[model samples]
Target: MNWRRLQAVMVKELRQMRRDRITLAMIVAIPVMQLLLFGYAINTNLRDLTAGIADQANTAGSRALVMDIVATTVVTPTLAAETPQQLMEAMRRGEISIGIVIPPDFERRRIEGRERVQILVDGSDNAVQSAAAQLAQMPLDAPVRTGPAIERAISVVAFYNPERRSAVNIVPGLIGVILTMTMVLFTGVAIVRERERGNMELLIATPVSSAELMIGKVLPYVAIGLVQTSVVLALGLWLFQVPLNGSVLHVYIAAMLLIVANLTLGLLISTRAQSQFQAMQMTFFIFLPSILLSGFMFPFAGMPRPVQWLAEVLPLTHFLRLIRGVMLRGASLWELWVDVLALLAFTVAMMTLAISRFRKRLD
Candidate 1:
């Protein structure tokens, strides 16, 4: 074992990391930024959302109920549509998520003891729909008295994510983001560092193989990525109350594959880039698409069709599916075979591309 040479390379890499102001900032600054921004800026619950109100009743009781609905912090009456047709058009055009309609016969129906107060809602906006549904269940003026029970012995429970907290969905995806930022950025800098310090030439002159060198460079980051995942899991569990209902080993296995794929991607990027600055820019360029398309901040279903299609190309998309399904849905490997297979394919492709790009002979 050439212990001195290995030690020299390791020390040199560490010194470079410490000396590079941008790298230091990224290592420290990015996480804090993400944590703070995500904590405060990102909210799953809909609040003060606009609703078009069409009140054909125009009666004292109906107006009072409408005013009460607008008074709540969750909803605010915006544009007043003359009819349901106009309100539906507004919802389709993304102008409003919710619309309340009081029919001309609203007071008549209530007087006659008929249940016909219609509430039109756009189910397409899942968050707004959920918030709107809860508001619908609330009676502003008085509860309607039904003559008889429509059914009995029925219990409806929302499954998978019962609380329907967006954090439950977002936390799993954050694991991928952490692994991506750490593994890819570190590995990119590591490979570029070897060449920048003339270590690559020295290594090529020795008996150490390219395969061995690649393995060595990749292992440290893989280990670090695992540590990060563990840290994130702990924080999520204790602070955010995200549950771990599935196999821990399964989470780790999927995580390892994702780390390897990201490391390989970093190595490939480093090989193409001339400097660490370029590598960092390249990483962000990729990171934007990864974060946006992987369904981290928004549901993939809610995104435009073009954006949804773009997200399909990211490895994080599949990994997120595996992690969220396993953790939140308690899905087994058999149920997530497709995602596992996709990740495996991604790992192989990325690693192959990286190894092919790596030059054994210094030039």
Candidate 2:
């Protein structure tokens, strides 16, 4: 290791590193990305959960009470329900996380020291459950400060996971996380692996159309993804005792859409990556945001408004809603059709984009 020779080697390595723009950019981009995500996007202390009000009381005191809850900023009143059943249905549909049902007898009950303000909490999200639970025991000491500081018991009913078990929330979401990790990792390197192994020439020489090749590449992974989903759901049910109260068909339908979307994303990454390392870097770039911002770890309602809009674009965000809505809430497919449509649209659009990119690369 002569000094001059070592210096020459170092210079050569620096030049090589400089030439790899993706690697160099990622070195800077990843750290900045992590900082932004953890600092701004990843918030565990959730606020502003979507809420509904069913003001059957129609009285000044009841209205005052509703205003008091809103002022707490624990929940934002976004929907209007005529009855508690309708409010519960809204929670089941994943529309709103909290439901305030002020019965017609609220005024009478308040005066009689029994104003049971029914709060229905969607307990499938642990962070949300925790935040909304505060509302139950929260001293409404100053909320209704019109008269003599009258305190009332909040009849908090946690629907879905009444126990507020962490597993109930985490297990269902694990399906999307697992699929995203394995499927993207597996397919992100597919085309790049071919290039690395000197099979690109053979692929180019073959008569297979780009569409056929793209289908052939991703089809096998679809089956594997479904299998992975089965294993995760089964383990979640068996080991964690997490309930699956919805249709098996619904779970698969959502899982398939997510699977295809991730695979296509991987394929798209494959089209751009010159090597497996680059493909992996690109995959990781997406993986972090998908987990952090997709409401898998943090509640979507907790994110800032702009961040929530950003989350809406992620496929995992929509799938989590569908999966949780089905497994925990026992919601019907039609009830969650908006999320269903979102996943379907993501799959179709991503698949088309991946195919076009692959064809362009092949050409």
Candidate 3:
């Protein structure tokens, strides 16, 4: 209850933190790094995606149509398949995002006033599938504009993100990064700070249980993380005009789960570290992989199989799916329940492990 002592400790900690060149440098450097990485490096555009073509119609007209598809800068034709089964296998193996299946009647149909084309698009890849579908129709749409065309265009419209904008897709992900960085980095170092300051014995003597003490230490950090997340998200929406298609309540709920999962992870790391410096190092080690493999900056599909599988194990992977699904896809909680459940499970298990380790430490 001594205000003077608390204030003295707070000021001393601030001065010492400021005087520590590494901490000061990190505070400034991390933000700059995040800004640069997010601003320039993160692009949602699917570029140079591999495509496969199974051409039953090897006529001149069919070749020209295939050529037009290959010409589109977005899709690169990597494989020529003789059968539909081969095309399906390639797509299943993730070797090609787009597969063009030209039927035997493609050339005959085009010549006989029937420009009907059968396009098989991979729905699993939203962006690449859209791109491929557009390319498939380009050859037909170019030369003809008549009765059914207007009706078809009106019916099967290709509106500019008729659902979600790139900004909306991206900003929600930034929320996850903010929560992860602030909650995990700060709380991970908390107990280590107590140990470094030789206050572990004093804290252990208090009546607070290890779980209660950990919660008390983590709650303030969680609040700070939420505040930062709100500020960044508001800036993204207001300044960039990002759309909010899904329920605001759902976004906030997802944020809460993500914060708890990341905070518990931080608490676990704090329990394992012997000093604040070591905790900070461990935090960075965890932070980099989470950011890189979280599909925040890079497409998870673009990575090698081993790398993609590695990312699947991280909570950030599931959390990113929840954020992007709710914000960009306008998905309901029902659709995102898997990600929500995964995060909830991760939080529970991590918190239990941290609390168990913390109780042992108290003894």
Which candidate wins on TM-score? Answer: 2
Question: What ranking of all candidate models by TM-score puts the best one first?
Answer: 2, 3, 1
Candidate 3 residue pairs in clash (backbone atoms < 3 Å)? none
Which stretches in model 1 have alpha-carbon errors above 4 Å? 1-157
**Residue-by-residue lDDT tens digits, candidate 1, 149-195:** 11111111233454567777668878998887778889878778887
Q: How do all models score by TM-score?
A: 0.59, 0.95, 0.62
Clashing pairs counted in every model: 0, 0, 0
Which of the numbered candidates is closest to the native, going by highest lDDT? 2
The per-model lDDT (C-alpha) reads: 0.70, 0.85, 0.69
Candidate 3 lDDT by residue in tens digits, 63-101? 766665555565678899988778766654445666666
Which portions of model 3 miss their true places by more than 4 Å?
A: 1-166, 360-363
The C-alpha RMSD of each candidate to the native structure, in angstroms, is 12.2, 1.8, 10.0
Tens-digit lDDT track of model 2 for 1-363: 699999999999999989999999999999999998889877777788899999998888778878877877888889998999988888898889999988898767776777547888888887877887777666664646433232354677788888889999999899999999989999999988987888778888889888888889999999999999999999998999999999999899889989988898888889888789999999999999999999888777767788888888888998899999999999977999998888788877877887887752333
Clashing pairs in 2: none
Which wins on lDDT, candidate 1 or candidate 2?
2
Pairs of residues at least 3 apart in sequence or in different chains that clash in candidate 1: none
